[model samples]
Target: MASKLILLEGVPCTGKTSGARFVASQLRGWHKNVRLFTQESPTNPVDLMNYAFLTPEQYREFPEEDRVLFPVEETENPKGYMIPLTELHESLQKELESYRFYGCQPWEVERPLMLARWRAFAKEAMESDAVWVLDGMFFQNPVCEMMMWFDLPQAEIESFMSELADIIRPLEPLIIYLESDQIERRLREVADQHDYEWLDSLIAFHTGQSAKPNEVPDLEGCVLCLEARQLVEKKLMSKLGLDRVILKNAFTDWVEAYNFIRARVYEKTMGKPSTDK
Candidate 1:
């Protein structure tokens, strides 16, 4: 089968969001139904980015006044109810955000939920003709949890990835890793583009998750942490043994990068290079 699941992955400021948009546009141009899910997308089928997961008992006990304000989804296999954080009032969300399944929970609790979600997603993808473009769900998000949050060993992380690979193998997923050789420069550029608060928050989140927070005190330390992360991610990508491509981008010429990515996606999905461009 041709690839229906296209994953664009990389660290911050690597143009993953732009790559995803380009890939989806290219697929749509080919008359294919394409769904582009960026990292911040609330309705991503595979990852629980901004949603709060609650047990059945907790769901029942949730305040009726607050619960009636928004839609709720119940999953049987995972045996939980999901409520979007955006739907809840600020005070209520603050109280429940820790229950989020992605970054807030430990890997042991998050692993099964991740696997189950992927299984369900793969089944649905098999039934549809639409192509799904995910910005960071495949490697980036999982890597953040395994490497930064949990500090798991490479072998253990590989085992977790292997299970996910098995579930999505039927979809013929393609992983496109966008990377820059100048990690520090890239991070600084991103930092320059954003406000001080954004950079401060980013450094805090990454450093605060570190085993030795004192070691990563500033941007220089954060750069080292990102360098380590990118290395691990690339290593894992090579081990996945799936159809994958690594694009070296400087983020200077996005048009050129888009052309290359579009061609690669064409080759993977249609078994030929794109002729349109």
Candidate 2:
């Protein structure tokens, strides 16, 4: 039997990567294998290349019915709109067409086929003793289980999610929302610390003005904004029937939040140390 796979999903800068790493480190201490996968990592150039093949024009020209190849649009209340991609017929058809071209389409190029691929990957990862921690805008991919982070402003989260809804919605991964005060804070931090000149240049090249800290292209699979972590916790528990979800602080206090999640993950994956100790 394969070990359980726990996925930590959230918007950019929601501490998904950092939190996953911390959790993985703790898991390793217990002799468990863990693999951290991020959409932004350069190691997975194949994934990037595949994404790059779909030019902006191709993306825009993709029939609305084919939009299942894309990510899910972010909604003000993501939990309320957790519909699976299989339900979007037009979008699924387009995705099958793309799959056929890639030669990765199985015997049945349908929604169930696509979903099966995800399950297979998760299962394979687990068999290898790897707990896959995926950090990306995966709001569209429907999985049997998921943990979505709902920590951002409503307008901002929606804006980011709209951009990727066209390419990643088919995977149907479960969501893990993180609650935060202002989504922009995370974006600004990344831009400030990392080289976001490309984004600025792109905006200036088009709009003839340096893109403001908050003005950038939307990421895929983001959804929802909550006033507090409690609201998010209540919604996930009620909607998914999961009693507890790992809730971390906003980007500003990411380090502390990371530690908290790490500790919880350790306890869950490995029982507390023996009292004899």
Candidate with best lDDT: 1
TM-score of each: 0.88, 0.49
Query: What is the per-residue lDDT of model 2 for residues 216-271, given as tens digits with 9 covering 90 to 100?
Result: 33311121221222343334334443223545545667666665566555545555
Residue runs of model 2 more than 4 Å from their true location after superposition: 1-3, 42-113, 137-177, 197-237, 242-248, 273-277
For the record, the alpha-carbon RMSD of candidate 1 to the native fold, in angstroms, is: 3.1
Worst window of 10 by summed lDDT in candidate 2: 140-149
Per-residue lDDT of 1-277 in model 1, one digit per residue for the tens? 7889999988877889878998998889888899889976767788877777877887777688866864677776567777788777888888787788776766765787778888999998989989989898888767778887899988999999988998999889899898877876776677677655666666665656333322335776667777888898888888878888888863878777777787889988887767865
Error of 1 at 250 (Å): 4.1
lDDT of each: 0.80, 0.41
Cα deviation of 138 in candidate 1 (Å)?
A: 0.7
